[model samples]
Target: MRFTLSSSILLAILLAILAWPVAGCGPTPSAPQAAAIPLESFSGRVLTTGLEAPWELSFGPDDMLWVTEREGRRITRIDPATGEMTEAITIDEVLVDQQHQGLLGMAFDPLLLQGDDRNYVYVAYTYDATPDDGDEQDDPRAKVVRLTYSESAETLGEPVELISGVPAGSDHNGGRLKIGPDELLYYSLGEQGANQFNRYCAPIEAQRLPTLAEVEAEDWSAYKGKILRMELDGSIPADNPELGGVQSHIFSYGHRNPQGLVFGPDGALYAVEHGPNTDDEVNLIEAGGNYGWPHIAGYRDDQAYVYANWSAAPDCEQLTWTGLTDPAGIPKSVPVQTESAWEQDFVEPLKTLFTVHNSYDFEDETCGASYFICRPSVAPSSVDVYPHDGPIPGWGGSLLATTLKNGAVYRFKLSGDARGIRDVDKLFDTVNRYRDLAIGPDDRTFYIATDTSGLTRDTEGGATDQLANPGSILVFTFTGGRVKSASR
Candidate 1:
């Protein structure tokens, strides 16, 4: 049946047809709008590849890039311009155990290459501990050694043990070394990953301090989860604060796993540490200060974190780990302490990467079994400060932090005094675990080192094992002028 329509009715129908939404023509319903990328213009290139689990990257006084291979147990030097590689040294004494345990953290002496006869390179690594007379086997131990670099042979030798027998385990070694403005060596040690996961029955001693007799006997059992300040000869600094009336190598205490340590231009020490499930922290480290761990996460607001002392549980070995709080199968014998319940005074973090409420949803169907990678924490690995005269505009006096889970560098703009973080912006996001980064001599180029393999969030925000650049150093050069955001 056909019917003739009036002119006015026909015009109205045409207008309605034009106003109807079309598929893929506009924003999708219930989908979030993606924000614009921040960088003006940049280009990336592979500076050097084929590294075996590169852990640290630093530019030496010779203008050559020095890297530590965690699993390879070797130190390599690379020419940044030509990408030529050279093996400086290979320590056969180093032990490599799955992912987190191996050679880690390298620092150069300030007098290196100055012909001052002090061309030293400090390295921290795990080693096999000698079993006692009756014990089956001893836990793994870590040591810090000083090696002299030969100018003529271009090799490292003459190993001098600075400190040894520190608490080390299969996980949470921390292992970050830095030379402070006072010309002292600063090393960060983790809590050995106790009271969680496989080691849930082990006690956490981050708050423990050594006795005066222990220091005299060289007992570093209380050194776990601490920042150590020492002389080049391995003696404790004279001016170090005496905590609990006992002086030792400990500079600060109560750290979980502080993997990133750097001295800012203002002479203040900064540390970046990983939290349990949330509240990754950027801290302004102070001598003798305690950054609460296991008791407080991020702030004392009692948000999403609670310190569950599984080691104190009566039947800890019998309970299954659900990796959640207040789950059904967990017994009430386990002591769970909130942030407010702790009465100790501790320093709060300068910045928390991402903090959420206790009710925040943690499950993500897209992440599948590796759902923890989809959590808010980015697993901060390393940090560096950009100078005020950096080549990139609006990036001066900023803190550049590297992440493992998110595979990105988070640029945090610092306040004038450098004590506060004004704001943060994510940059150089790729599907690779960013282990460390170093600024080039020109300040226009940035060299980022990535792990050989790891789980990282893909572009679609799902957990994936694919990496764009593995075991390689990527160079990101800033190009002036406005253009579309470029990231690999």
Candidate 2:
């Protein structure tokens, strides 16, 4: 549950290396390397429908799945046994903003089965209205609120402010929350204007500069673009790493917008991050480590923000990521050029290529294709680590993740007993297509939250509905005693 700072940084570096290409090659293989294997998936009946912008899922005290609808402003409960769903509670009394403000994340009190008979679901969401300065999105209180549910897992008690005062932006409110193996609630919050650097994905304005005094004396205590860890009761833990005489509640900083947080079977906290245009990242969160966000995406370091004046040595291979730059400006995009400048300078100015085989202009006419991969129809948004104390029937151990675009939940079985799963794409299978998923105590069934983007799987249908969903929860029942054979 805890790791030293050194291990965290090392893992970050390892993630960077895995994310980018290394040497010059014609193009990387279109498929994952030989060692990588496909993962298996089983389909189940769809449980509930008519959910509006559903976000996260967790198990309640009564063996029902709890879901949050970002736009519906409702907490829903689904019976895992029957796959039937009902709106347990609706927040018609509380102010609801149809925009980014709504229920975003949900977490259950582990003690629900223990001391208190009360069923409680903690949530992070945006409140109605903003500060006069248009900075209300950055206000912490407006970002996260905790509500208690009745014993039947329906209705609500008066809302309690567990921890408030987190900064919100018009968007990029990294409000995903989860209680880690350490029994601490770890959540993410992103900074405003964090999207500008990825020129290809969204319209980006020029970067801003914080005055030197603002940079040093600024109060980072308030959450914004940080991964914060606290007790289930919402108090910052004491053992968190310290920075500058302050016990940084920030387990790690420099994240753009991390939507996924799941502890791997190995007990490591793993995160799935959406990058500007080309990069979508899966990171291992380590205590006291800086994820190098607003400063780095994937393995590429941002030279503009100098950390401690550590001038990254140019010739130093480890300093910057040159192998891959998320094809800036493209969403649901795949890499066109597999060759790195470090290997073939002749292939500079890589031109964009479309799925239809049309080519964007590139100066390098001599270039040849080596890798012809497409962007995944589903962009990974949230992840759930496998082999929990609950029932995860036929499947032995796996990592479950969800995609925003595809509305499919994927379960990845790790190979080798390492802290990381190398070349995961190789293990990808056709059935691995469900959104955020959680295993039931019955083990045979796992619940999934569907994005309901209504996009066709062929033309990248699930891309834009990252937040826009008439979302719903469903249960997947495994018929065979074991997972289906993994496909190639």
Candidate 3:
């Protein structure tokens, strides 16, 4: 919500830079584009390590790096200068981790920048339905709360719940939050955690079916499979697309676990979504628009996507997504319809990936198969518009997208008024599940949270993912050069 300058002014500066455009960046269909920042321009160092499962990061008051740890169930304040954990507020009681669900997104109230008396940090997390439940998902639900920040005490005070009962599961809890320039809160909800289950299961059981009735039974609006917009105080806006004032918080629906949401420089909303095995997408968000999932993935309703490990072929169309509820609570879609989700009008992603396997391509090989892509997908964990006056060429106006399965950070540049892709460059890659990210107030320095839990679990738990390393927060400051074929 607190941009250093007005978007209009930022756009003006961006236009001036765009005047001196670089070479060969014009669109081509088959090949990946060249890096906007020369290979030598990029360098990274660990800001800190030992984060259990760091999920989100934000530059809070006094320039402290505020981070949310999913497995630790705490919001921690890190002194970036010394890479030390200075303080933390534990919320493990309401922040259970389900590998995917846990303490998630965070945003600082913008008013704090203007004055000191009422700075509150909003945190979103998943809570257990009952104590010591055998099930890991355990009927766990999601919630967003505002914690008072006390600069004097260097602590986060008691929390006040703003939104509650958002749909949740061990996977696909969609716990990403962003406050818009309008000062309203925007949160995402995935499709009932069903996709994560059906991704592997064959001959799905009827019991796994989730109906519109069951979805509506939750306290919040048609949250699952939707993006919700609410006032900072949790009230519905008059401009919201709700009819008759019921189910008022929905900003848009029809998404399959949107992991990243950020407003572009032109004030347009963007979302990064995961696909079924292939075609992971970066979409341009529209209010009240649908992003097809379970029914359709990428641009079309493709049916057959196979899991290379088990070679299990599952059809997206044959899979079941029960009913879709309109904002007014009426069923817009017929119950239990198994058709191409594309049949019902839906928007397409701005960019798509074949898979996460080739995220770090050292060179354009003679044979593409030599450089493998991750099997199921390369899940994008977070995305942000880089608003910076920085040294990296053409990065002053770019999208910084971070990954989970592939463990890479990508910088994307758009072309023309349509915001279509001009290029996609892999900025860096590492042996970590890069979970979430945030840029500094200066915008020149960027920060990322990695999954120590995901990376090291296999090694420590006696499994065999040899890429294990301690989870860490990485700081990258860009400088320009053309050095080639190097990686850490």
Candidate 4:
């Protein structure tokens, strides 16, 4: 005999199930120390191979692995269980202006996770500028577009332009997209750092923009050296920091190649922006807060800009330059560079990653005292904080930063309130340009994307290895015991 359920009895059962809490599904962890545990050993394994310059890796609904290829102009979805390619979409409109520019950043519309019937994906890329000008303007501009995905057909529809005409350059088109805790879309901007002002004979003769007013004159159209906050439809949030102008999307300004943005376990937002020569920085992002780039980098001092290098590096002629004694010898061509009289209102970075050599001009400690000498620069690509109770030992309450320069993943062990740093450790160091990393549903799983070309750059020039390594997607498993990572 079967038991029949009444309508009231069925309603009560549904409500009870809805109220039940699920593990690994809750608000962001408030305190990392509560979940901290000693992690003595760890191991990792390569999951899939033959990824062409993979830029980003993230998990969507149902733990489907989504990845973006920088040079391929495509997004591929892979089945984590069998390492099979499930879906792939090629975005042909993306323009490759230089070695670094292409289909660079992508993110899922946060609304999709709410179980909406339809969801869109957002991507940032360089678009051709001055399509009509066959003779002159060949500039590359940055744009963000939204597109709908059809799982049944496994195709991406034509893109709908969300925000376009943002300034972009070959070397410093800061392309990193992230959905923030506020449920808004946030993206970074770079100043196209290789201006080479003195050699270009100012903005008058060679550079078209004669005055700095065009850049800093309260313009939303110009997306140089800024971080923007916007709604899903690409409208500027009204609550964004007000600068007395229509350029309201500006969340923070004065940045140089902000490559990484991550929301911490404690709900804090952090940004990792690259420096020109020496001072790579990791800053605590704040509304209306300016982490000075061209003006003051890392710390409040006049010597910061002195480290900004141009084409022929090892240009130690500054040690014998004529006009350095002047307190205002920093690059003053740009109008915004002189703002607030170099005040300390700009937020200082939590830590300055040493990317340069300390000795300049044959063992000159005085130069290191004032400015960081440029041996090379650390090109940090992406960052993410470990969720509480993660399986990796001592990694639950720490920060993980991935890099392209040295092809290393560095862990920043925190000290106070998630602000101060206790020490940094190498989770795993490999000879691949690590572009992105994502934590899986369980603490025991994680993934990384790498630019696996064997070509190596040394200071100014690079040499290509005879045996080239193709790009790959790696899967890491935490066994919960101290183990040899390389052996595994």
Q: After superposing candidate 4, which stretches have Cα over 4 Å from the reference? A: 1-40, 132-137, 197-221, 244-247, 301-341, 355-376, 452-468, 482-488
Please report, as a residue range, the 10-residue window in candidate 4 with the lowest summed lDDT: 201-210
- Candidate 2's C-alpha runs over 4 A off are 1-41, 92-100, 115-119, 129-141, 192-222, 300-378, 388-395, 415-418, 422-435, 452-456, 459-470, 481-488
lDDT per residue as tens, model 1, 1-488: 11133454334323322222111211112122212233436666787889989988999999999999998899999999888999999998887865778889999999999989999999998888774444322568889999999989988999999999888888889999998889999999999998888888988888999999999999899998999999988899889999999989999999999999998888999999998877888999999999998798777877777888889988988987667444343568888888899999999988776667777777777789999888778899999999999867677898889999967787777878998777566676667899999989998888899999989887667898878778989887788764332221
Alpha-carbon local distance difference test for all models = 0.82, 0.50, 0.63, 0.61
TM-score of each: 0.89, 0.66, 0.75, 0.74
lDDT score at residue 417, model 4, on the 0-100 scale: 86
Ranking by TM-score: 1, 3, 4, 2
Question: What tens-digit string does per-residue lDDT give for candidate 3 at 1-488?
Answer: 11233444344323322222221111225334543444335456677888877888878767888888888888888987788897568875665655777888888788774575667888888886665767646567788899887776777878898877766776676778998888889988776555234443322111122344543564553466778888888776778874223446777766767889998767788888766555677888887676666555565533233212111233444444421211123223322323242366777777776422223232224213322232334678889887645555566667878877555676777665636766666654555567778787766677888887543212111212344334688876655465343221
Top TM-score model? 1
- Which candidate comes out best when scored by lDDT? 1
Task: Judge candidate 2 at residue 243 and give its lDDT.
Answer: 45
Clashing pairs in 4: 39-393, 39-394, 41-482
Off by over 4 Å in 1: 1-40, 131-137, 324-329, 482-488
Ranking by lDDT: 1, 3, 4, 2
Candidate 3 C-alpha error for residue 50, in Å: 1.2
Report how far off residue 106 is in candidate 3 (Å).
Answer: 0.6
What C-alpha lDDT does candidate 4 achieve relative to the native structure?
0.61
